[model samples]
Target: MTGLRIIFMGTPEFACPTLRTLIERGENVVAVVTQPDRPKGRGQQTLPPPVKVLAEQHGITVLQPVKVRLPESIEQIRALEPDLIVVVAFGQILPKALLDIPKHGCINVHASLLPRYRGAAPLNWCIINGETETGVTTMMMDVGLDTGDMLLKSATPIDPDEDTQSLHDRMSQLGAELLAQTLDRLVAGELTPEKQDDALTCYAPMMKKEDGLIDWTRSAQDINNQVRGMTPWPGAFSFLDDKLLKVYKVQTASGAGNPGEVVAAGRDGIEVACGEGSLLIRELQLEGKKRMSAGDFLAGYKVPAGALLGKKDGAVGA
Candidate 1:
């Protein structure tokens, strides 16, 4: 433990927590590697990765390699001579050459229970698929995508009303805690990596902006799942007069009518008909407008009774 020199690789806020946790516990993080600063936000300002900022604040050496697989970047990390490399949401795949450089090998703190949710956006997919339980896993690095030997894991129950934003915060902290404990065992040589069962593997594909489109032909439950899954990012939306109408909050309704019809509207909310049931839209935001309650949207807009509430049938890009 006394001579353990660590190199930490991470990018986002999710990774910041783990880096801070390691530093607070007095670990020797010899270097920090994160993605390079990139244009972000509406103004397109160049912003540093969250992990990079934290590392600089603590006086840790920061490396932002644009192409991690390049020979130069691999050589830089190899020269560090780290005892272990800790990665959390590092935003890049590691090559075997870099993985072999560390004395104890690399460890990844993944937000999902592997072999399930193996891709980039695991937490969002878990909520989208309506999973009641999900957890964190620390695994030994491998060349395959999140296909690594499990070192440690712990589960937490998902609440019925939990959305991606809430669940992500919880999982982020949980991953930090689990990762710290895993490093403790590694220092003591008390941990053993276990191979994952490929037969039970599931994948969580990265989300696209077009994936947020709401189809009235899906069940209210599925629609609700999408709304929760996409919240705070790539929001679930429908079309109204060929404009995108982002749906922020909604609940399943008991009543049913023709799909895509606004069956009722009042202070309670706007109940829109779905394929199998209905959705009580509690919160929404129309394009070029501020987010407002469904009741407020109805108050300002002229939505005639029995009028269809989505893009015209067969209209492209609706």
Candidate 2:
């Protein structure tokens, strides 16, 4: 357990906690391998990845290779003679050469309970699909994508009011703690790696901006999930008076009207009918405007009853 020469590979905020935990627990982290700094934000200024920033703070050597599978990249890592390569959200895939370089091979801390949810945006998809439970999984990496053998898993319930941002923060902490336990069990030879069943696997591809387009034909509950899952990113949106309207918070309501029709628009909330049930819009943002409560929006804008929302392209029935 002690003196385990670990080479950490990761990027983004999610990976920071794991790398920090490993260092805090007295692990001998020799070097940090992360994605290269790239231009970010409105100014297009280049910025270091979160992992690289954390590594630099602790004086750990940081490696940022454009192509991690290259011969030079492989050699650079091999020179470190790492006992274990701990990977978490490290954009690039590791070649077989790098995987074999580490004494104990490589291990990944993923944000899902494999093989159920596997891929780039598991946490987002879980909430979008209305899943009641999800968790983190630590696996021994292999050639296949997230098809690695599972070492340990820790489950947690998905709160009804939880948004993608909140769930992501929670899962990151959980993954860090779970990873610490996994490393300890691995060093003690008490860990049992189980092969992931491809039959139960589900792919969660990277989210697209268009994925937030609200379809009133869908059930109210489904649309509510979309609002929760897409928050703070490609936010859930619908067309209102031919302008983009982003939905921040909503709840199921009882009403009967054509899908997308505004059953009632008042200070209480905007009750919009769906293919099944209805939705009470509690919070939203109009095009080129700041987010506001339904009551404030109603007072300023006149969204009278029976107005068809999503009528931009005549998608909703008249």
Candidate 3:
């Protein structure tokens, strides 16, 4: 509620909560800076980013810069005279020119506890790596990647069945709450910055579509994590008879056979043997078909016992 000249920068749905919180708390948000609208989905229709839509609804100025480091973009930000810059999942790096223009510098709402998951796609990587706990961090932005002093943090435990989409929703709201508290404490001058230990750093690189390919050679538990970690994005997947079969949910089971071999198939699920154990496929999407339960899939499609499943590449499973 202070008279700080705040400028919000973000693009995806993950950043919406923090912006909404600032607006609700009566922050003087002068403008919203987000990436340029781009084509998305099957239609390839160009649409405004969620942040831009939210900002427009609130009657805040929206800025879509192709490159935030451009001289014109830097001058545009400098013209705003922002006392503080708040960045969530903005997708663009703020150059030194724009960072220096803000009176209070820049504060970032990172999706992980730095310096643990300090790169892009932290949420997905945490689950993919089988991390039992993770959280959000508000850091004072710097030239380096999430290497700034941490202002505040909020942690949450990862559930056994948690996926990226579910965890993303929860963490988004949590981040908003934490950022509100951080801003209040900053205004009251009651906050002390904490330095992150670089030795604990682990990078979560940007994900690619191919990253979702399932390798049956791994343990059942590891493959299960990979399925959930990539959910609603690239999607963990394998091949059945040279066709793509996307896997959404799975449960570890006890079995012994060659990795990727279909040891059992029935109403409960299709039990496929893994390198160590096996996995019961609960949900999946086969090529030229809709996502369905294992039972429904079994009713029409046949995943016969002793059948192989894995990458399309020529291999034992293939």
Candidate 4:
């Protein structure tokens, strides 16, 4: 455990806590590898990944290889002579060459219980599927996509109103703590690596912007899940007079009308009909407008009762 040379690999805010925890705990994090800076936001300004920022702040050597699997990248990592490589949400897949370089091999702090959500965007898919519980897992890394041997796992209940942003923040912290514990047991040689059951595995494929398009034909609860899962990203969206209408928060309500039809729009909220039930829109953002509560949105813009929402050309309830 003493003089453990660790090389950390990660990107995004989800990975920040783990990197921070390792550094703060005085672990020998010799170097950090993160995704390259990319243009972001409306200004198209290039920004470094959160991990890079944290690593630089601690004066750790930072690497941003475009392809970690490449010979040069692998050689660069091999030169570090790290005892272990810690990964979290590092956008690229690590080849076996790099995986085998570390003495203790690589470990990942994944955001879901393995053999379940075993891909990118696990947290988002878990909420969209209406899972009652979810958790984090620290695993021994392999070449396969999250198909790795597990080290430790910690579970948490999924709140009724939990959105991706809130769940992400909570899981990030949890993953950091769980990873720390896993490393302790690993260093002590007290942990057994458990093989994941392939039969129970489900993939959380990377999300796309089109995935946020709301299909009102789905049930109220399903739509609500979509709203919650897609928030702070490609937000759950329908159409209002051909303009994109992003639904930030919604709750199930009682109403009946054609799917996607506005059932009520008043001071309380805007109630929209779905195939199975209704949705009480609590917060939303129209294209080119700021996000606002349903009441605030209704104040300036009127959605007449019985007007249809969703794609103008698509068949209703298709």
Best by lDDT: 3
Cα-based TM-score, every candidate: 0.96, 0.96, 0.98, 0.98
lDDT of each: 0.88, 0.91, 0.93, 0.92
The deviation in Å at residue 291 for candidate 2 is 1.9
Q: Compute the lDDT of residue 41 as modeled in candidate 2.
A: 86
Off by over 4 Å in 4: none
Q: What does candidate 1's lDDT look like per residue over 227-300, in tens digits?
A: 89999788888877767789999999977888888788888887888888998889998888899998888889
As for candidate 3, its clashing pairs are none
**In model 1, how large is the Cα lDDT of residue 184?**
80
For every candidate structure, what is the RMSD over all alpha carbons to the true structure, in angstroms? 1.7, 1.8, 1.2, 1.1
Number of colliding residue pairs in each model: 0, 0, 0, 0
State how far residue 137 of model 1 sits from its true place (Å): 0.4
Ranking by TM-score: 3, 4, 1, 2
lDDT (tens digit, per residue) of candidate 2 on 114-214: 99888899988999999999999999998888999999999999999899999999999999999999988988889999998899999998899888888
In model 2, the clashing pairs are none
Q: Put down candidate 3 lDDT per residue, 62-85, tens digits, no spaces.
A: 999999999999999999999999
Error of 4 at 54 (Å): 0.7
The candidate with the higher lDDT, 1 or 3, is 3
Q: Candidate 3: how many backbone clashes?
A: 0
